[model samples]
Target: MKVVIYRVGQNQYATPVESIQSIERMLPIRPVPGAAAHVLGVANLRGSVIAVSDLRKVLNVEEQAFTPESRLLISNGNGYVVDEALDIADCADDAWEHVGEQKVWQRGDQLIVWEDLQA
Candidate 1:
């Protein structure tokens, strides 16, 4: 399957390319009251306002300040903040292994994790 891979610290994560509506640069976010701990708040993309979540928090990774490479993966009107947007790669179905609840791909010394942000 073709996937868009992104980083969250030293770790890499992937999601099906078709699953996300668009990949955008990090935008200014407005805080939302009574939102989930993982939710970063909301962002205005173009003219649409969407909720944004911290992928680092959701993936239980170390949180860091957004850098120039930080990105927003927009899916179904929701946005997920990631450390950086990596690349779009075609991964074979057999390359993926089910590791507990995560779909993981081991490429040499690096491991790529699959996340269903659309879910």
Candidate 2:
């Protein structure tokens, strides 16, 4: 299956590229009070307010300063976040075999968290 690979913490994870809406750079985020620490804040994405989450913080990884490579990967019905959006790659279903036994999280029975890219 084709997937959009990305980096988070110290590992790589794959999400089907078809679900991605867009990849954007860091924009001004309005801090939300009384929200989860992982919630970076919200930003206006082309007139639509989007919630931005810190992948590192969310995964309990060490915090790192945002660099030019840092990006927001909006997916899963336009409501998702990833660390650095890596290039899209085509991988066969067999290729995913290596991902076995990793922490996988299901999203609506459609997507699964392959692995922590930071690892």
Model 2 accuracy (lDDT, Cα):
0.67
lDDT against true structure, model 1: 0.91
Steric collisions counted per model: 0, 8
lDDT of each residue in 1-119, candidate 2, tens digit only: 56777777666667676667778887888888987888877888889987777878866778888878888887642333555776676766654433456644333333345743223
lDDT of 1 by residue, 35-62 (tens): 9999989988999999999988988888
User: What do the candidate models score in CA lDDT, each in turn?
Assistant: 0.91, 0.67
C-alpha lDDT of residue 12 in model 2:
67
Q: Please list the Cα RMSD from the true structure of every candidate, rounded to 1 decimal place.
A: 1.0, 6.8
Runs in model 2 with CA error above 4 Å? Answer: 77-83, 98-119
Error of 1 at 41 (Å): 1.1
Off by over 4 Å in 1: none
